[model samples]
Target: MEVIAERRYQVRGMADLVLRIGKPEPFPDGRNFLCPYEIDGPLTQRRSHFGGVDAVQALLNAVGAATIDLELCEEVVQGLLSLHGQSGELGLPDPLALTRLRSAGTIG
Candidate 1:
């Protein structure tokens, strides 16, 4: 596996890393599939954290998605929030809680 794409930037004192890892075709046949990208941020380290990776993971878990599709990221977060405690609420129990079901490890 190799990093097909990498994007990094800094915001204030914080830094972020987003990577897309996947296998490549032996030749440039143009039949390869698009690999999912990963999201990484320093929000988890802050006292108040939410959105970013936290939001992405919740959606992956909810949909059991193998790839991180950003298009559905917002929708996934909304859906998770709509399942508050199974009491038919409109928000999560913690409501935008900062947590991660899967850490941003190396992906291929």
Candidate 2:
């Protein structure tokens, strides 16, 4: 697997970690497949609490994603929220609530 792209965003006081990961040569000789890793953070402890191996494992499990694809990060975030019982609506939900989901480690 490989990381083709990565992106992080700040959304109205939220902790979102959007990334793209995937295998190589899936799309073509010069292309590959990628998946998303949308996590939440105030990232509190960059290396201890939220930036360790466990965190990566949790993210992998959260989205059932093997690779990182920022394109699908939003969907992964929603799924994580839903798993945590925080995602209220399908396409739309409360923005603050989403942030809370990340902080709570429900997405992890």
Clashing pairs in 1: none
lDDT of candidate 1 over 1-108, digit per residue (tens):
344544342323334323233332222344322233354434321111112234344333322222223223332333331222342232213322323322343332
State which candidate has the highest lDDT.
Answer: 2
After superposing candidate 2 on the true structure, give the runs of residues whose Cα lies further than 4 Å from its correct spot.
Answer: 26-108
Candidate 2, residue 34: CA error in Å?
A: 8.1
lDDT of each: 0.31, 0.36
What's model 1's overall lDDT? 0.31
Clashes of each: 0, 12
Residues 3-108, candidate 2: write the lDDT tens digits: 4544444433355543333322222332333233333334321211111134344343323332223223444444432322344222323335656898999885
Would you give me the overall lDDT of model 2? 0.36
